[model samples]
Target: MAITSANQLELLQTAEAVAREKMIDPGLVVEAMEESLARAAKSRYGSEMDIRVSIDRKTGRATFTRVRTVVEEEELENYQSELTVEQAKQYMADPAVGDTYVEEIPPVEMGRIAAQSAKQVILQKVREAERDRQYEEFKDRAGTIINGLVKREEYGNVIVDLGAGEAILRRNEKIGREAYRPNDRIRCYIKDVRREQRGPQIFLSRTAPEFMAELFKMEVPEIYDGIIEIKAVARDPGSRAKIAVISYDGSIDPVGACVGMRGSRVQAVVNELQGEKIDIIPWNEDQPTFLVNALQPAEVSKVVLDDEAGKIEVVVPEEQLSLAIGRRGQNVRLASQLTKLDIDIMTEAEESARRQKEFEARTALFMSTLDLDEFFAQLLVSEGFSSLEEVAYVEIDELLVIDGVDEGTASELQARARDYLEAQAKAALDAAREMGVEENLIAFEGLTPQMVEALAKDDVKTLEDFATCADWELAGGWTTVDGQRVKDDGVLEPFGISLEEAQDMVMTARIVLGWVDPEELASAEEDETADEEDEA
Candidate 1:
């Protein structure tokens, strides 16, 4: 192909055709053509020479040029492309270093080998531009639902064609063992769009909980219009799922709106999910109330929530135990996910038995430690005194409130409890010292002797070690693993240390060790208080 040929307009026409076919900017294709022409010119006119090409956008006229750049004497390296200031006087009267000298050069005729190389360069550039376009188009569409056609199956993975790009639905991301043949229509959630070496990798998921939420958004006009919001969703993909929704408007019922008339809206989502059952529950600001709603078709007699531990215990009638738990613990598991809390469901009789056991344990503690008769210990336990610390430190008025308890009896009871606690603390302190606990840790203001011993047992002997510990490490916490909540035992958890108390104690230790500035802590507290005030 020669630039001097009468078919020069064919270059611009071809660029336009390629750009249109690939849905890319025509200017990109023209730039690729220019690059290929330059590469081809470099091959013909000594590969060392600096060759450049430019084409007129309207006339399709290809212009070839030879460029030489002036440089410093010591910096001149390429003899063909660069020239020193002293040797550049031949090109111009006053040539300066770092200046380019250009002259028009006749375009060369591309041979078979050169034509093939040029074609390859242009194709490479076009492919890169197409990849960039595809990534840009789909990156913003992540976390959304998409409709596509199954292109093929490779190693149990389904490749879906989205018209512009292909997405991979990994086997684990598929709903159950659903199969798809070529050209099968499919809908999936665009979980992610990642730019990789070969191209953009679009990951699609049919089992994502968000996919159910998106489907409901499409089916419910109220949700799409912002009147109703899906608060949470949990799925056992292709088996069963639970969704909690809230309504901003007073007139609209979120659950009813999601269910639609005659179960039409939810049924549509269920069909897409391969007949997965869905429980639509109304969202509540009160966590316990919302949890009650989440465990549907089962009656809950009472709910006991341990907020700090993020755990809830539900008491139901004996007959409702199986219903509340569902088949293979599915119902309670879904409820736990929807509520973001670990739930323990038990029958009313079981709860009663557990309460009785606790009462006996507290009674035994008082009997053994305070030397109290069974009747007095039971009375104290019934009046909500469960620990020696509470008995020793509680107001005299609290003890007087119990029948047959006078000031003399209260004083003796408190004295006995205090003596027992002092003995336990002394023993714990001695044990901690034997384990090499430092004086600074024992003298810390907030930590009790039992807590110090626990810390020493865990190898946190010094104040520095205490300062290095995380709040969760001292107060226990819940971790999400494999979509299930797992318990992490903390050294001070048995001491009934709450997360906030643990945090405060650790920060105090840090300040005492000069590791944290008191002024910064004060400033942070002020800022937090101000934020809370602003929110209120």
Candidate 2:
């Protein structure tokens, strides 16, 4: 083999010099160079042959070799045509029929191929090293804020140059109202950094509520020192925001402190948000008041909650309702998001109507009990019964016994027992009228008259027979008995009935014979109501 010339020596020297300067291992550079040689050879010579190259690190000399398999086919090119067994003998002393031989080829002209290969290998190594450096630099910056220059905007996203790398401030991450220009000094919360073939990819956001929260901590001393805590924050980026705050010290006003003197503290935050309104509401233990405060500057008169609906109905003045609801519902919408309450804002009129319905319901319960005698009456007055139904149906007679109600007083309690039965009788007659009872049938009995008079004597307790009686008898049955005008027990005697029996009889009679039958009464009443409605 001939010794290499100074030009080859110079190439080796140049390769080693480039390796040292780029801080890449000389072995890696050599391996890359060999890979390039193989690729170029494959492209030029095809797969029918194989070529190999090696660089000796110590001497900086390059060597070339060729390989071919032992073959039985006489037609094969390399072995059959060139290396005869006598020639191959110099390569292998023990060469056999199936064994192959190797021969080193002297260095060939590879100037163009090696130069191109070296250029590509250098580029690849440089890329790999740059990638490794970026991975190490940005890996520790996740979940934190990093300073970067606004390099430029690309496709609506701002590219930030973090001295060691670049990050993207995507359109979504940039606060909508904040603008960015090249070289603008801005602080963004570094959300994450990831590795890709290109380099370390960092993502930044200025719109994250956490970003605002972090900035507040910087501006508010209490927050930094841990004296004040931000319990929750809700925001409509570029419009309004609500922050709920609490303080450990009882004397500190959480809202006031966050607002700063003359609005200085919160103004800094507002400026950051481009004049978006900020409401610093004090955190509350009571949900009602907390909700009230959440919809600030729009006075809340009352809040009606429907927990099952996960909703709250807030009543403010007619004027304030709009404010409470906010423009395009943004105010209440943010409040609802913050509090997780489906808020419904209402005006004073709606609240008043709600209260009136509630009042009527309560009044009905009280009105249904107002009529009893002295003992029963006073018992009711004492026990909250203000109606006749209470006296008539006092289930616990022991209540009367409790207040020293004696035998005669107790017996007097039954006076209206007949009157109640009589009233029930009149209600049936009215119901009959509604059922299209002939006016003549109602007047035919003057249906309630005889029953009322007989009840006065405690002789007739109901309207069953009165409902059965001819109208002439009903109108005249209350004849004077021994100068006192009264319907005689004789009137009910015709039915072989006692006073209690008379009362029940009247109900049954009114149900049956009073004109229209009882079953259709409700529909009849509804029809009458409809007819009246039509007439009106």
Measured by lDDT, the strongest candidate is 1
lDDT of 2 by residue, 1-536 (tens): 12276555654666677677765556666666565655455445553546666767666566655665544446347642245445566777855555665456655444676557656865786567656767777788776777789999999899999887788999988777678899998788888888887777889987777777887898999999999998888888878899999999999989999999999999998897778788898888877788998998789999888653356888999988888888999888778867777677889998889766755544453344334334444444555544444556675474365476665655455454546656767776665554444444345332354334443343333344355554323222345468444543344344334444544445456775556566687788799999999999
Alpha-carbon TM-score of each model against the true structure? 0.94, 0.51
lDDT of 1 by residue, 1-536 (tens): 89864767889999999999999999999999898999999999989999999999998999999999999989989999999888889887799988898999999899999899989988999999999999999999999999999999999899999999999999999987699999999999999999997999999999999999999999999999999999999999999999999999999989889988999998999898999999999999999999999999898999999998789999999999999999999999899989989898888888899999999999999999988889989999999998999999999999999999999999999999899999999999999999999999999998899989999989999999999999999999988899777899999999888899999999998898898999998999999999999999
Native-structure RMSD, model 2 = 24.5
Angstrom error of the Cα, residue 30, model 2: value is: 8.9
In Å, residue 17's CA in model 1 sits off its true spot by 1.5
After superposition, candidate 2 runs with Cα above 4 Å error? 1-110, 132-136, 192-200, 249-252, 306-308, 355-536
